[model samples]
Every structure is written in C-alpha cells, then in structure tokens.
Target: MDRIEQFAPPAGTAGTTTDVGGVIERMRGFRSHWPPGDGVAVFNEVYLTVTETLGRHLSDGAFRDREAVSTLDVRFAERYLAAVDTAVSGGLPPECWRPLFQYRLHPGVRPLQFALAGINAHIGHDLALAVVDTCRTLGCAPVDLEEEFERVGDLLVMLEEQIREDLMPGPDLLQVADPLTHLAGAWSLERARDASWSAARMLWRLRGAPPLAEEFRSRMDAGAGLVGRFLLTPCR
Candidate 1:
C-alpha cells in the first residue's frame, strides 16, 4: 500500500476515544501501519513517546488534579486524531494541519522537518482549542487548568528536545548555512506553548461570542498553517 493507504484507520478505530490509553493505541496503530521514514510516522512516533510519558505520570499520581489532567490529555489528543481522520476520509483538515498532510510524502522534506511541522500544527492550533474543549467538558475555566496544561507542556518540551537530538543531521552535515538549520532555528516549542496558553485564554473569553471565537480560530489556524508550510520547505 501507499503511505496514505497505510495511514488509513483500521476497521473499527476511526472514531476518537475518550481516554488517553485509547488515543495512544490509535497512535501505535498508525506507527505500525506506516513505514519508519514516512513523514506522518515520524510525527506519530514523537507524539506517541510524549503521550506514553504523560500516561506514566498520570498513573504515578504526578498531577495535582488527575481527572482534569486526564481529561485535558485525552481531549488534546482527540483533536489531532480528528485531523488524521479528516485526511483519511478525503476531507479537508484544519488549515494548520494542511501543510503536514499535504507534504507528508515529499521526497525533499527531512524527517526532522516532518516532525517539527506536525508539532507546529498540533501545538499552534490544536492545543489552545483542546484547552477550551477540556474546560467545556469538565465545566471548568481556563485558569483552573493552568497547572495541568503546564505539566503536559513540560512533557512535550522534554520529548521535543529528544526528537531534535535524535533526528537532527550530524555536525558534519548540518551547518549554519543549511536551510534546515535556519528552519529549525525559526520555530520554538516554548514560544508555541506560551502562545497556546494565551490563545486558550482568549478563546475562553470569546466562547460566549461564537462568531468572534470562530474568527479567531480561523485566523490562528491559517497563521499556523503558514508556519507549517515554511517549516516543511523542501530542504533536500
């Protein structure tokens, strides 16, 4: 099968599940489906590692509010899974997700580019919205979830550093003059996490104003997609 076919959801796993374990299961399914070098697989592998880490923390009672954190984690994962389903079903994913899906199989894009582009889309767009979704589901406010958000963000940050270390081209090949170096330098996960928190707060405030919330979401999606496009610039 082609890469896209490999990404297709197995017979009964297309719908989003309500638990972190379920989300991790779906991601693992994707990992097994795609080739090691497949762009989506690259991102899936990174995400899977972070999610597994979060799950361990949850089991170990690491969070102050386990239920809230669990809800947020599951909800957060659902957004990305939904995007994958959209692409698999031949529908348009959110603008922020478009670039990675569109360029998934590009020969010119490195695995690092694919991984970062997917991270950009997920954090830049999905994260803020996930916060809103989690709040709505739990009948809580954004402020209430601040600690949980930070904990999750910290896990992601740790995994991101590992991803860079593992995927980056060696010093002999990745020079200051390389476009990959420039692209990698241009985006910061820490910055993205801060922006996502701000956006989540803004979105929460706009919730009562549906039209405004949608407009803000649309703009954020578009802006993120633009960045993803830039990150995926064929560096080969």
Candidate 2:
C-alpha cells in the first residue's frame, strides 16, 4: 500500500465535527518535528495560522453551510498531510508538493519563499481537488458549495496579505532591483484562487471520464510544481 494511503479517511467517510480540531493538532505536531527555521516548518506555521482562524470562524457560525465548509476544509488539509506523510516515509509526493519537501532543508531559501511555495502547491493544486472531493462526499455539485468556497478563499486572501507583511523583508531592503522582490511579485494568491475554481469546475465536468480527469490533474500538478520551484529559487 502507498504510504500516503494510510492517512486517507475510510471510503465514503465525511468530515466529522472533530476533524477540524484534528487537523489543527496535526499541524501543531509538525512544529515539534521540525525547527522554526526549517522550510517545511516555515510553511506549516503560516498554514497553522489560517487553520486556527478557520476553526474560530466555524465555531462562530460564519458560514451558510457549516457542515459543507468544515468538510471542505478537512479534505483540503488531508491532501497536504498525505503528501507530508508520503515524503516522511521515503515515498514521492505529487509534483506540486515536491519542491517544498525537496528544498525543505536548504539554507538559502527564505522563510517567505517557503511560505509562498507551500501556498502555491496547496492553492494551485490541492484546493481544486479538495473541492471535488467535498462535492463527492456531500453528494452535491461544485455550484452548491460556492458560498463555502468563497468564504474559505476570503480567509486565505487575508492570510496571504498578513504573510507578506510578516515574512517579507523590510522595505529598505526590498527594492525593485532585488530578485526577491521580483520573485515575490511574480505570483498572486488571488489569481491562483481564480484558476483553482476554474480547474475545479473542469474536473467536475470530467469526472465521468477518469482517464481525462487524471491527465488534467497530472498537468496541473506539474504546472504548480514548476511555479513552486521558481518561487523557491534561493536568493540570499
């Protein structure tokens, strides 16, 4: 059996009320396994903040369909966790996740780069599939989950801004001439979200054709991986 398969929820299982808390705990556990300066840890910290915020919002009755949103969030998180497990067990993760795991220990990559690269892999690749997974588990269509998708996406956009503010270099040192500035500017979370939505719709439409769906997913995985690689370019 694949190493990542061990983390998969049982067939036909939906996200439970405890799933969000479980996700938070798993992310926290990564901190103990990896130092603050580790590339994977850098991204894990940023993701933990977003997950914690989402959990709070779920508790506050922020969504129209809390169950659907919660399920989507859990499904979204499981993909990254699966990839992490796969890498830890000496198995290859998806193309979109390879860059972060491979360069996780490289000293030259900055924290901000690690954060964005992980975001790129998650949003640019995993998110669309998560949407599809949620739709399947809920027995609903992608259109049915639009509200939940937007609300979750809004949280991500806010987090992306905060990540830049917190992780980016000081303005005095982040001039246009700096390669880091250009590298950071080259990717946009908003654009990634839009593209993921389009991909989700496409994947949904292609669901009946498994071969085509896999092909599209493979292409997306490779493309996101390419972007992640470029984002991780070491510029010390």
On lDDT, the leading prediction is 1
Q: Per-residue CA lDDT of candidate 1, range 1-236, in tens? A: 66456568676777868888999999998887777887888999999998999999999999989999989888888989999999987789999999998888899999999999999999999999999999999999999999888888888888889999999999998888999999998999999999999999999999999999999999999999999999999998
| Model 2 worst lDDT window (10 residues) | 8-17
Q: How does each model score on lDDT?
A: 0.91, 0.89
lDDT of 2 by residue, 1-236 (tens): 67334333333332333489988888877776566887888998999999999999999999889999889999999998888766776779999999998898788888999999999999999999999999999999999999889889998999899999999999887777888898889999999999999999999999999999999999999999999999999987
Could you tell me the TM-score of candidate 2? 0.92
TM for every model, in the order presented, reads 0.97, 0.92
